[model samples]
Target chain A: MSVLDRLAPELITGAPLLVMQGIAKRYGPVVALEDVAATVWPGEVLGIVGESGSGKSTLLRMMNLEDTPDTGTYTLALPEVAGNLFDLDRFARRQLCARRIGIVYQNPHQGLLMGHSSSGNVAERLLVAGERRFATLRARAREALDVSEFPLNRMDDPPRLLSGGMQQRVQLAKAIALEPALLLLDEPTTGLDVSVQALVLDTLKRLQRDRAITMVIVSHDLGVIRTMADRVMVMRRGRVVEEGLVDQVFQDPQHPYTQELVHAKL
Target chain B: MPNSERGAMVPGAVVLQVEGLAKSFQMHHLGQNLHAFDHVSFTLRAGEFLLLKGPNGVGKSTLLRTIYRSYLPQAGHVWFSHGAGRTDLAHAADVDIALLRRREIGFVTQFLIARPRVAAEDIVAEPLRKAGVAAEDALEQARHWLATFGVKRDLWRAYPTSFSGGEQQKVNLARALILPPRLLLLDEPTASLDVGARAALVARLADLKAAGVAMIGVFHHPGDVAALVDRDLMLMAKEVDDVAV
Candidate 1:
């Protein structure tokens, strides 16, 4: 049985938390993303599958608001805000990002502060969200670390001293400390050893199921997408070629490019 | 012996012999000595591939470095059999060791240290040039290996220092394998490489094994190299014994 089945059945259900339509982005002469549309429902896990330079990362960056979609209606349904994200001013978008989004990059170093202690790294996210009390910050940080299964004894150790897998755990803890509604992961286990990759994936699965946090994970590894994603989207050359339930797509891929990808994995 | 499918007969005589290998470090701040390994012994035959397995901090990497003569072992002997003669790498003269390294031994580490302004192709060809191959011939051969490792032809002229970790690692592998050394020591060679690059490396290593090159490699994921490895060496952390002052 899938690990997700063991956790409390996803309790959150409502209108999709995020919606994008006709998203298009370009870098000079290069078309990075083109008319890509996706909807992430509350408590859903969406896996974006594509090789390098396939617009998967571009779509993710647009969702994170790191890059604005040149043309599209990007909507994030947060309690306090309801409108196209690209329509917001930079300052307003930044506020919404701080409040509602958590991102974990493929490189753990990019997501983590190597100089700060592990717990300090987790606590810093809360501090940025305006939590000032030391006791509360410490408590929340410890809780997040516990959820990620990071060793509490090494809470004071900087990330540089930790192994690659441990550093990823710390990054996961820090990203989820704020309990954001949406989590964005880009090739989270790409470089980790197989055993360590299993651990990180297990932790992510447990957290996603228990907390019912929505997620969009991008990876070139079909194994990762097969294990983690509830729905799968396949992109090729800056456009979505296929999208469907994970089982449906895996069993009978409609797009020729997706069929080639699935065959390569097998 | 794992009975590798390669079934290539290893040389009857051992290519490398180690006895009573021990290494330790003095932790001055902690006022204690860290024992890396103790009384380690092994023999590697020509054309045999040995996989070193152990957890972190167990001295697997330290043992590899000591064999390469980069790190000094407190007490041990590493006898490397070469065409000229058997040289105790543990106690070899500096000049002899340097010459042996250039001609007989090659080590590939996880990271590459490329000099600034040097093109990737030149970096791969440097070893051959040092060994007295013509620059043109060396570079031509370097291009062949670079292409084998899947490095784009256009990037061959650019500096490797700016390449991504996987790309630089491919360059490092090309440089080490270009000369086709008698004995190769690899530490996590596939750590940074992608699936395609890794498969390419495995294929190249298989070819080298068929050609009778002995190797000792440390792999975090042994399954990746299982088809090539003939034997396994497991290292355990040594318990530190307090020396009474």
Candidate 2:
């Protein structure tokens, strides 16, 4: 079945969970991002590609409404709620982001508290998602760990003692613990070696398939984006240089920059 | 463990040796005990890169602490053998170990908790200062090492606190390399770095290995250790095994 077919019929009926139109952001004298438009459909993985200082992070922040864009039309079809993300007040935006979205940082060490155990790491996010019952939190955390292919037997070990690959898996379990509708992964496997990177990415793709978890993965590595993304948006100099299906963008990239990236991959 | 390839040098000329090392802690508050390291021991040659691998709480930290003389082991002896000087550290004085650390060993802990908000350059110079080098000469040596580690000249004066974890790691690395100690101990040195930064650090560590600066790297990730180390030192429940390269 197609990605949209996996989603609930109600969500697919002309309802884009995230919609960004002409979003723009500036930091002092520098314009970090400008004129970015995209749509994240339920059960689909959207890849965002850009180099350092190219404002890919700014775009990801704007997508989840973490940072307000200077000027843009932004709308989110959140579960049981709908609003313009850019226009929402602080509390409202935070509430929406917390309930419907989750973000995983690139630096695995900073993403999760290294002092806490695997179960503790997963439960922290569940508690934040408003699930406070101790037994329920444990159940959910274990379930998430199972889905992410994490070794549940070693759930009591602190993150610092776990292997680097296992640490990244704990970060994944934290993000997906609450079954967030939209997941944002920023260079999820950057520092990990090839074997660990393969494991983590495979786990992510499986969860995205089984749970219909829509994702927005940001990466400087084109290979990473190509592997996970159903739809790709190329960002450069704070703008959308190209946007299309992954196959179309990778096979017949329209932008000259896109051509260079594809050529580099070969 | 003994070094089999003792050629012109004496067979017992191994730089360092440990036999049946073990450590445990009594948690008085919980009325329970924690075994940090158990029956773990290995040998270090003049320039060997020893990589320690295990899960969290599996005693990697404890092993490093024991080797660096920070935490005394409950059982097992840590000995240093170099040239005519053979020192058994199990019964060595704390002050003597401290002196040895200052003069012969350099250590980098896993966490980067800043103590002094000194400039990156001066922070590296502190070790040389303790070694009795002139302040001006120490600063020049520090600058050379910093440049070697790829820290820009403009950023030399920047406080380590202001830099990212990777930058701070480079500073720590520079500090450890400035003294040119006989042995270097690292715990999770690349945990906080990105791909580019990690590659740079690994490249530098390879150079250090070539120069025969004996090192013991405690790493949680086998992949990271696999890239730079020559052999694996896997820590099982209460024993240590030297996995072949």
**CAPRI grade of model 2:** incorrect
In the range A1-266, model 1's lDDT, one tens digit per residue, is 21111122122235678899999988899999899998888777899999999999888988888888789998988778878888888888777776689888888778888988999999988988889999999999999999999999999999999998898889888888888989999898889998788778878976875577899999999988877887789999899998766754665465668777887799
Error of model 1, residue B145, in angstroms: 59
Off by over 4 Å in 2: A1-13, B1-245
Model 1 segments beyond 4 Å from truth? Answer: A1-13, B1-245
lDDT tens digits, residue span B1-245, model 2: 11122122232236678877777754433455677777777888766888887766788877876776555556777787643266655545333454466666668764553333357888888777766678899899989878866777898988787787677777787787676566778887777766765666677677666656678888656576575676768887776776766
Instruction: DockQ for every model, please.
Output: 0.01, 0.01
In terms of TM-score, how similar is model 1 to the real structure? 0.50
Clashes per model (N, Cα, C within 3 A): 0, 2
Deviation in angstroms for A106 in model 2?
0.8
Question: How high a TM-score does candidate 2 get?
Answer: 0.49
- For A1-266, candidate 2 gives per-residue lDDT tens digits of 21111112221235667888887888898988888887887677889997787888878777667778888887767656655667778877777766777787787676788998888898988777688799998898888778778898988899899988888788888887777888989888888897678678877865764566989999988878877887788888988887665655675455677767777788
The CA lDDT at A101 in model 2 is 78
